[model samples]
Target: MVQLYNNGAYLLNGTEIIEDNSEANAKLATKLGANVISKDEAATGTIAYGILEKHNTSGNMDKLKIKFDKLTSHDITFVGIIQTARASGLEKFPVPYVLTNCHNSLCAVGGTINEDDHMFGLTSAKKYGGIYVPPHQAVIHQYAREMLAGGGKMILGSDSHTRYGALGTMAMGEGGPELVKQLLSKTYDINMPKVVGVYLTGKPQKGVGPQDVALAIIGEVFANGYVNNKVMEFVGDGVANLSADFRIGIDVMTTETTCLSSIWKTDDTIKEFYEIHGRKEEYKELNPAHITYYDGMIYVDLSKIKPMIAMPFHPSNTYTIEELNANLMDILADCEKKALVSLGGAVDFKLRDKVRNGKLYVEQGIIAGCAGGGFENICEASDILNGASIGSDEFTLSVYPASTPIYMELVKNGCVAKLMGAGAIVKTAFCGPCFGAGDTPSHNAFSIRHSTRNFPNREGSKLQNGQISSVALMDARSIAATAANKGYLTAATDIDVEFTNPKYFFDQTIYENRVFDSKGVADSSVEIKFGPNIKDWPEMPGLTDNLLIKVVSEIHDPVTTTDELIPSGETSSYRSNPIGLAEFTLSRKDPEYVGKAKAVQAAEMARRENKSLQEALPEIDVIINKIKDNYSDVNNINTGIGSVIFAVKPGDGSAREQAASCQRVLGGWANIANEYATKRYRSNLINWGMLPFIIAKEELPFQNGDYLFIPEIKKAVEEKQSEMKAYVVGNSLKEFTLKLGELTDDERTIILKGCLINFYKG
Candidate 1:
């Protein structure tokens, strides 16, 4: 159903694809009748290029410095972003900033800390001239889609799923520091990324939903890095066939492909979407120029897509429902094997045990969050479960609308009644299910969710506590079908049900009554609320002339998600406090990482206080003596001591800065990895003054607890050196080279100055 182009391709009038092969350029010239089209000129024809050019503040197109029209964050992130901005001499929010309380709205954990953070957000919004959406009103991306998205405008958010490309707006999900830059009137610096063309054709089949198409694309592109760090520009005839909501479902999952951002060819469907949300003036016609060139192309035939499901452990472990059902035992065996690597054998995970009479059964089904909570998805799910019942067994179902307006419309159309009548509980708009803060399943339970991720511990399971569950990602339609089957795994296509396709009616009064919008007017006289758990960042030292770092953790997993670095769920309640949250760093993946990192941190603290490192950490004397034996210049005062982690691939999921910030607060100075999985994660490392180092060899040169001494490290970053030499300090010292990929000048400065906060402090 999906095909990837291995080479560059050209889109003719947004429909025909011409592969840039041996004679394609000559053929293009002949078709255009002697008109020479430069690649740069053709690039400007893409919708993404047009939007990016409008937001580019740098004079040169090659090196873009972007200033977004607006900014957004959720409660889990806004606190840290605001704290960083405030430390950097923030006068007022330069642009419209929306802080939504969706991640930690339950206030069920950490006593009153969650609600205290909400109050802090409200008062901060009032004092800084911003907007704040209260809990249950809308999730972060939903609020942005309903109110902030505009045609051809660019928006930056602190959530990974921040995508509004279907609305003809280019939105990116980055770490909080990027938003802090925009808040401080600084530009987001980067080299212009190549754009990939996603040419769609044919309408989807009856049972196939937008998540099916998205999963198919993600499975095809994720492993091969087809669209990694590139803009995905959707085009072609199929654009008109899908509704605005369908396009949104597919767009939000684009983060799984690791793409930078996305934009689409807008039509009346999008204009009607804006009209339905009472923002018709934001609509504008956006399409590819007559001829557009792309670095790559992904051609998708929507008609052939099947009811798909991403098996446990990752969103990319995809298989059609038919295939999975046909080969249940074999697939379950494979999943069980993979679970060992993901779960670290903490608990015995068996999907086969859930199978009864050759059919797999799930305990829970959820159609919630930004991916599944849209109006059409919920209406169709309600239709599927209209008269059917989710049996009174262990199986249960819950539905969450994307926003209060969607919930209101669902109630008005009687969908909520139908769902409740069928034993499904309808809940308010919340992101807990998607990020593991709510609806935690029982031990060893299997949950089918239409959420963003299915990573381990993302379903609120604590493997360290011998509690492990699994989540398989499926479309809302199929999830509803499964619920109707009373937890027996069933695809929507297996059932014969007609969709109601009820029309959506937005209730603006719901937002007007609950949301607090500053309307860009700041009141300096307002007193900012400060919660006890909300603490300022600790002081960080600048890069030293020489560095000594002990490898605290070594993870050989193919990819380590942010949840593994620092867990979600209850840990989110402590996100406002850096040190409080840092205690959980690598708690899930490496339980002893915190103690190891803190030991190194204590040494650095002693150095800053002009105390003996041996006095602080008695174990450090052995490594320091080993280093000084060979290199006479090495000393406690000259060498900065910290910890580092080596992973095969890290930073695969989420845009939370805590993954890196937590490590930085714990005295982590660098991360050595084979490669980084996402741009946002690497940016987090840079913004937090952590060296994102890459090793070429698959075999690691140093082991855990081995100290690596690098001389003249600060000078190397200042000199723009790509490669640096380091020596393992032990009985027999061994040297290895590490590479720092291309970094912008500002990024280099941020590292040299300690952090973004320190960069501005200077």
Candidate 2:
């Protein structure tokens, strides 16, 4: 029985309850002896509060804008941003920025391609007077956790799980456009988000993991969108029962819930976490008011959570290990059905092959990244696999701790030794497994992972390349159980074992020895490294009077993940090189996408070179001349030409800026979507100066190879208009209205400026 932290509650001392206040706590808490929120309060408290206050749009929002230091992205994304910002006239970086090189840590593909991105980052960090985190020292989240996170502060990353709320920071995972707003010194605007209390009452059972609890919560709230876009504030007795490491393990996975951010009621355990990390000064006891009122609540009894698994496609697709064992065929069939939506007929994908002798057998097990690589989680996995070999068969296990600190602690406690004795490969902190650059499996392999995502092609396989693999989300305990059985799927609950909570000793010496901390200094003498593959961003033209987009492809998948757009594995290293990486765009989903996009782009290039449209692409001339007959204003004028793809759902994983840039490189202009997957991907589009247009879910009027024209696009974007008329050039021009979602003031300018990079091109 998985007990959730039930939110529907009245504060009680065993049954004696107290009711909430009269008005919205955000408003009421500030009035009459409390701090009136005033919708627009700036920093009245600390640096963190100042950042939060600026974004609180209800009151005097403008006055709070001056506080932020700056915003940043990395090599995996900055090229597009810099290109766009430069198009808008970027002169110099406004604030202290950073460009890290952790994503393309695997340098196996395209030869020196990953290093090129790192060199580009080093140069950009120097040129822009920002920081640069070299590769392999830490994963993105772990590095951010150690260096960037501050109490009560706010940071928006292009990565979807840009949350670090446990450290008293109000971090958000948003698209690139939001970061552009910050880099341009513009405030982020949003309606105040509803805060939901996740009240945990009981302690967790043994052999369970943070991934299990997170999966359990996701299962409860995901399907119905109960906690979507809401802040989950964890509180209550169960919070006291869980150790700081355990709490953090669960906290890291909260981003998968699609929530804005999360916070836990800070206690001595939290304080100790800061002290152990050698930042005791940053510790502060954070708690809601005695009469706090949340919009809603989720109740979790930690003791009830058991070994869990989120089958393929989504984190929300969850069931227990026992449930999978009890009805293997039925769930396996369900997964196959889901594959139709996820894989989109790309390959024959299935989970049924894992079954043998009435039990499931997994080919691989991994414990890595922010969600799984904690000291406690690794120690537990080590204990479970104590003297058991993973076997000489296809079954294998690997473990990666979050940081050097955690890794050093594991070694100090002999957890590394134990894992090694048990045949588990312990590696450094790299996000490759989570994004598929490492530990690639054979075709039709099934892997259980404790990493962040298991999106299609995220298992280090390429469908177009005739390689395919799949993964299931699971805790180390259960993964170990399956490993111990030499590949038979087994639940931790099936075998009882004692879990000894061991104390961790932090050794910062590793980071102190290896990490180069600039401590916020500007060194002009440092020559930026510009590798051959890392070229300047293509000159993006400003938004024209109208947009002519050729629909190159249409994706009907419920969601189109970034991995599908610009796959994982080898391609991860080329994010910094725009044109080089663009060649791989839509390479996996539609192998012919690049050629098709390039064909349309050739027309745009010809136009740039002052060649006649009729002379370049005779087919485009016929379509445009037909449109000119209807709308006299339509002429072969100075306009940008690009290709567009309509996906039912897109922007699902990784905040790599390239997802949108590749489209821009291929002469793409706008994306017509039913809905976007995460905030980060949408922001990536807007920051790249692409029009994020949406049409009704059922009313997709345009098809591939069709031309769409939207007149007065820049004006329409400037003045917020949900509906804008777009023309499809076919037999006769069929006009359809597409909707542009809400955009903040800075966001509008970034689009007008062609991107944040151009905007900052001072």
* Per-residue lDDT of model 1, residues 582-622, tens digit only: 99999989999999999989999998898988989998988
Q: What is the C-alpha RMSD of each candidate to the true structure, in Å?
A: 1.0, 4.2
Query: In terms of TM-score, how similar is model 1 to the real structure?
Result: 0.99
What's the TM-score of each model vs. the native? 0.99, 0.90
lDDT of 2 by residue, 13-43 (tens): 2211222434434334344245433322311
Candidate 2, TM-score vs. the true structure?
0.90
Residue 478 in candidate 1, Cα distance off native in Å: 0.4
Computed on alpha carbons, the lDDT of every model, listed in order, comes to 0.93, 0.73
